[model samples]
Target: MLWVKAFHILFVVSWFSGLFYLPRIFVNLALEKESVSRERLLLMARKLYRFMMMLSVPAVLLGAWLLWLQYGGSGSFKMPGWMHAKLTLVILAIGYSHACGAILKKFERGANTRSHTWYRWFNEVPVLMLLAIIILVVVKPF
Candidate 1:
């Protein structure tokens, strides 16, 4: 169970690495306004997004399972305030991911230029979310 938790953390970290970087790439892609560069950036964003989807969802599920294990997988699992906050942030992170997917679909339809400002703003979303997640996980700040 500890091993599973460790692996979940590893995957989460890896997924977050992509999450932090991909939006910056999207920003660059939006700024470039060049066909070739945009194509490359879009390709990179798509690939990184796919990797994040493959990694983070299962990692989150495993983390949830580990939380369940803390209470022996029964309804007796008492969550701290910070854990609840962390869960809210996790759900928000998932929402941001869905937003990214929507942006990707727009990109696929050549609507990328219209979403430049939103993409730039999206670049900052994960940083704050990651901060909250780290605080919740480490300091358990309620």
Candidate 2:
């Protein structure tokens, strides 16, 4: 269990590093006017998005494993309310990742209509989610 918990933290941190930076890439992509630079940013975004997704798989699976080990077997779940909240945020984080993918697709198709300002604000979403998740897990504020 401790090993699982350690790896879960490792993968979550790895995944969040990409989450934190990918939108910064979007901000640059949005502001880039040169075709060459735009293509370069797009390439970076594609590769990062793929890498983020890969990291997310293990993070999420390990998280689920921790939950199962903690709350499984007896089939009587007495999970804390904070855990429920954490799971909700985790789901939202996953959705945010997919949303980034969709945005990347839009950028690829030359259909991005948003400004860099929009992406800058979008970049903050994960930060806030991370904060709330940490609070829920650590503080367990219920």
Candidate 3:
């Protein structure tokens, strides 16, 4: 169980690394006017998104396993309010990641309409989610 928790944390950190940087890439993509530079940023963003998927899968699976280990009732876990809130943030984070993919696709199509300022603001969502999640996990203040 401790090992599972360790791995869960490990992968979560990995996922967050991509989550943090991909948006910075988007910011660069949004601001870049050179076609060659824009193409490069797009390639970087696509690869980072794929890496994020890889990290997220293991992070989520290990987290679920840890939850089961903590409260395995007929192979299911009954979570507390803190956990529920954390899960909600996790879901929102996933949605945000998916939305980033859609935005990336729009960039690929040369159809992105949002400004760099919009992307700079957009980049902050995961950071906020991460802070909330960490607080919930650590404090468990229900």
Candidate 4:
């Protein structure tokens, strides 16, 4: 259980790093025309998305497993209101990550060119999600 928590924290950090950078890749892709540079941007986006799928998903799963072990239907573990808020933030974060992944798949398939406006709005999603996650972890509002 201790090992699980340790790895969870480490991989969560890595996952957040990928999430933070994935949007920047989208922003870059939006700015460039559909040329060789666009291919490069797509490659970057795909790589980041792949990293998230491979790394972040497992990390999050392990976390949920640990939480279940600790708190799921167990009188030994009690969850407070603040922890519930944190769990909500985590779910949102996971959703945002999946959305980014979908966008990356579209980019990889050479789908419609995204406008800067689109990228900018999408970029805010991760940032806002990150802020929520941070608050959930640190402030832990009840």
Candidates' RMSD to native = 1.9, 0.7, 1.3, 2.4
What tens digits encode model 3's per-residue C-alpha lDDT throughout 21-115? 99899999888999998988999999999999889999989988877777785556677899999989989988888888998899999998999
Higher-ranked by TM-score: 3 or 4? 3
TM accuracy, model 2: 0.98
Candidate 1 lDDT (Cα, whole model)? 0.82
> Which regions of candidate 4 are displaced past 4 Å?
73-78
**TM-score versus the correct structure, for each prediction:** 0.88, 0.98, 0.95, 0.82
What's model 2's overall lDDT?
Answer: 0.97
Give per-residue lDDT, candidate 1, residue 56: 82
Candidate 2, 65: how far from true, in Å?
0.5
> Taking the tens digit of each residue's C-alpha lDDT, what string does model 4 give over 86-123?
77878888888898988887777768577878877877
Candidates, ranked, lDDT: 2, 3, 1, 4
What residue pairs clash in candidate 1, if any at all? none
Candidate 2 local lDDT, 40-108, one digit each (tens): 999999999999999999999999999999988669977999999999999999999999999999999
Q: Where is the poorest 10-residue window by lDDT in model 1?
A: 107-116
lDDT of each prediction vs. the true structure?
0.82, 0.97, 0.90, 0.80
Candidate 2 — which residues are off by over 4 angstroms?
Answer: none
Candidate ordering by TM-score (highest first): 2, 3, 1, 4
Clashes of 3: 0
